[model samples]
Target chain A: MNKNFIILGGGQAAVYAAREIRKNDKESNIKILSEENFLPYERPPLSKDFLLNKKNQEDLFFHSSDVLKNENIDFENISINKVDFENKKLFTKNDDFYSYDSLLISTGSENKKLSLDNNLNDDIYYLRNLEEAKTIKEKVSNKNKITIIGGGFIGLEIASSLSQLQKKVTVIEIGSQLMGRIIPKQIADLVQKTHIQYGNEIILNKQINKIIKKNGIYEILLNDNSLIETDFLIAGIGSAPSVKLFEHTNLKLDNGIVTNEFCETSIKDVYAAGDVSNFYHPLYERTIRLESYQHAQNHGICAGKNIAGVKTEYTSIPWMWSDQFNLNLQLTGICDDYDEIIERGNDINNGVIYFFLKNKNIRGACGLGIAGKVGRDIRITSKLTEKNIIVDKQILADQNQKLNKLIQK
Target chain B: MSEENWIEVGSTDSIEEEDLIRFDHQDKTFCVYRLTDGFYATDGICTHEAVHLEDGLVMDDEIECPMHQGIFNIKSGEALSPPACEDLKTYPVKVDNDKIFIKID
Candidate 1:
């Protein structure tokens, strides 16, 4: 009898892992379960093309039924209540039980909810899946006063997308600067200025204390006793990993489900990937959890390959991208522990790429606008820190210098 | 060397050393650059978008994409930037005396 592989959570990571598994083991029975009914779609476009109504729902899907059929993978649209670790069975909310030789948890993540009152009726929204995005797009009208909570990448991208639709968008962020966690102050200022130029109002250093709905309109009160009325409220604050399903199981949990380098949980024959798995990172010398799409897809592929009897370790440089109001931001490597930043290009009109360097090496890179223009430069910069190569900041700034030459040294 | 495969592209006087030029052959765009060492041929279209690499400024040994400003290596046709996730195709070039010829295949 062919072994059965059961995968929970049908997102990009889950889909990619299923595909990779089928590639290596063609006869294995693969079943993917997703809470959402839709096929695996690209989540990155939810804030950009999909939100702007420029692209339809069909355009965002990564794979179709024909592809799934050809690969002989079964997809189940059901919510999993819990996993029976000892029995090797999964109990679905629909009262169905399925047995598997191996199980992968790729439940991705859900939006972090605000602590305010549940006055969140139809007017308020959280953009995560396709349904939420479509509902918000259909409800928003011209000249609608939109209040978005959070100044992170998703919130800013939604602000840019909504502004293009001629909506009066106001972004309320508790942090003093926009994208405070991901980018430096200088680059964040450029992003803030770009949003301001696009006619979007951004309120920083303000926290939303309460959300009150009166007469079909939502009034948000800030921590400073300031109130703003809007037709809709969007909370893009952040996301928490969907790890509650494994609460009863013996799987270890740190901020997320603690997994080893091989994506194996403490429970035997069980693994986790994507946002749910907090895998150990060799570079950071700790277990780091990433919520980016690239990390999710990479994690899924790694977990899938290992589950298929191939011994592989997941260790790739973390990378992510954000499209906000004509700015294409690409970041590679971890930037949290960087000591200094090396700026490349002018910050006026166009944008600049910042290299987060430590000990004369590139630890991380944040490119705003045309930062990725020099492809070789970005690739070499990602390794500068790890390889312990000495680089002149001026040479990197100068467009005349060859990046390949710099890396060759 | 052999002038049989070399087709007369343009006058040698028309293109100076270290200058880049564009030419059409068999409906495909080709960029001809006269480096200090010799001449080389590469796809004119930027790998990121349909922007022409000929319109972009050339620095050192690479050409910047005109649309999103993605840089590419002239010799290897490797995209050295983001936005463009692919590489351009490079073609062999031969110059006989004063005539320039680009290999189509």
Candidate 2:
């Protein structure tokens, strides 16, 4: 008898894992349960292209309905209510029970809500998935003054995009600089400068105390005893793992559902990936949960292979990208534990590439405004091994030096 | 006279091994780099944005975009990274009597 694989959640992780499982196990019965009633689509474009109406929903879809039907994969748009790990069965909210030989939880994440009084009206928005993006785009047309509650990547990108649409965008960040969690202070200032140059206003170190809606307009009260009137409000606070379904299960939960390198949870024959899984990183030497597209896809790939009886570990380098205005940003590896930063290129005129060096080894890199112009045929090894190689910041700034030469010695 | 395509832009000794040089020929910018194996040529401008690839660092057989760290294959002109989906154009170059001649057409 062929084994049956049941994957919960219908985001990128679930979709990619299902594809990889089918690739290795052709005869295995694969079923996916998604809470949302749509096909697996790329969520990265929700803020960039899709929100701007540059691309439609069809373009963001990763696997079409036809592909799902052709593969004989059963996809149900129902939310799961409970998971019985010992019995290997899942109970959905629609009163459906699914028995699986193996199960994968890819239930991505949900937007973090704000702690505010009930005075705010319906004009406030929090962007997470496609539905919220569509609603924001629809409401943005008539909105004049838009106050973004967070200065993270999503908030900054939305500000950039809406400012291009001629909306008065103001970003309220509790931190001193934008994107301070991911980028350095200097680079964050540059990103802030880019937003400012485009006529967007950023209010730093200001906490939103309260929001009062009156007369079709919202008055935002800040912690600094100031008030600002806005037509609409957008909250890009953060995201938390969607692990409510697993509340009754025996799955180990840390910041997220704890999983090993193989994406296996504490329960036998059960796995988790994407934003819901707190996976152990070999490079970082700790369990970390990433909410980016790359981590979700990689987790899905690893979980799929393991479910198909192929033993593989998830050890790919962690990388992410963000497009705000015309500035294209890409980051590779981890930079949280780095001691020093090696800056390359002209920060003001050309672009900038930052190397996070730890004990003379390159551990991570962040590039701004230079993604499209770079070559694509180079192999990026773990920066751990590149420590022995000698590289000068001046030589790296030179446009003529080939990257391959830096790795040869 | 085919517009005399052969122009002595630089001498072989002008560039050392693993060094890249930017040259302007016929109002077009070309970045010339000497590999351990051979010499390679590509567009002076990066395909992603305005950052100059001639200012980028070359490693293995590719050059890291100085601006965004996007990697490109020096030999094939393929973008090996994101943000840059387009490939750079490669030109043919030959060394005759210590002078470097690049084929424009």
Candidate 3:
């Protein structure tokens, strides 16, 4: 019944939704408003491939610009300034008003630029999109000393990538551990060790006090009274949801735009997906705002199917991965709020396995590699965690027993 | 190079613990998977990105990409989950006793 479907933000969510909508309803006009000039591209490669020079600009794009023409989808490189819910339309920065029968708010998150007390703040860079990655790539060349702020996924990924290019990397984290919010502390410590093993300095439990430029270099003072000099600074402190357009609108907002299981926002005839959605996940039985490729793709498909009159619910399990050098760190389900943490392998090197147990069941797991078998184990136990199946704690902690056999009911 | 389309990758013992082994024939790479049930073969690289499937981990008949956790069905070379969209090219597996062979076009 909805003919004109307008999607805001031109990331993975918008692209996937456009594809799904086109597959179901051919006659509906699909328009995507993207702030970036480039086509929808893969964000993961920005810190990995784009930095390593393994992937070029063409490789970054998910589809060619002609894809819009071929797929009969309307894509415009324009920023959406405001949403007019009263008129069922949205206003662009160019003063263009777009009316839609149905709207999808896929506007992803933006990099939270650190508000530092220094005039040399302009010298620091943050990698969120292709443009910023390109800028960092240009700046990183022939530059030896690099000070990275924050120890999150983005910060760490960029750290490992820059260190691969043989730059003296120093990662400064305010937290005592890396990836503290997601993985367990033991795993975070192992990651820090791995970085140190790779000849990168990791200074934790401290942050920048202030910064200034001295003789074409950045001299950063830390809260611990220590000093660091670097060619430049790259801060991946964190990200905030791109919900600025919803200030005047009646759309419910929290960490992000709130959505139901069907990826439908509180507002009727409007939906939300991707990183910008704080969706009520069926598995977790709570509202979650996930920033991952899997959720974006699945949520987009679910929202598109719902928009096309299909009653599809997004129920995919949340999983995340990080590649540091030869190590593969993978986690399935949430690790927080577990009653006990069962650890196997050496927590220092060759990886360790942390089975987050609650109620005598493996609710989730994190695998770090000194050996490369944790990912497979996570896959075996992920179903158990999702289904809330009770597992023998001893069997789970035992490395000799096959996880696949233990999981068999 | 061998008799007909079947080319011996090595013995069945060569693949240890469900590790995906990459075998090359002509100009294409095929990932030979050893599962608890049986042997399977598919395109070596991930359908999502240009990454070797052998670099990923294999559980049962599913291969998870190392770059992203995109899974692929080893028996049919079907892209089972996201980040992955296109189905991989599946090749027939013919295990001759201890020696295993893959049939690729």
Candidate with the greatest lDDT versus the true structure: 3
User: Model 3 - which docking category?
Assistant: acceptable
Q: Model 3, DockQ value?
A: 0.27
Model with the higher DockQ, candidate 1 or 2: 2
Better of 2 and 3 by TM-score: 3
Q: Model 1 Cα displacement at A191 (Å)?
A: 0.2
Query: What is the DockQ for all candidates, taken in turn?
Result: 0.12, 0.16, 0.27
Show model 2 residue runs off by greater than 4 Å. A119-121, A370-400, B1-105
**Each candidate structure's count of clashing pairs:** 4, 30, 2
What are the Cα lDDT values of the candidates?
Answer: 0.79, 0.78, 0.83
Ranking by lDDT: 3, 1, 2
- Single out the weakest 10-residue window by summed lDDT for candidate 2 chain B: B1-10
Deviation (Å) of A321 in candidate 2: 1.3
Which interface RMSD values do the candidates have, in the order shown? 6.4, 6.1, 4.1
Error of 3 at A262 (Å): 1.5
Chain A vs. true chain A, TM-score per model, equals 0.94, 0.94, 0.95
Candidate 2 lDDT over residue span A49-116, tens digit each: 78778878877777678998888888889877878788888887676899999999998888888878
> Candidate 2, A353: how far from true, in Å?
2.2
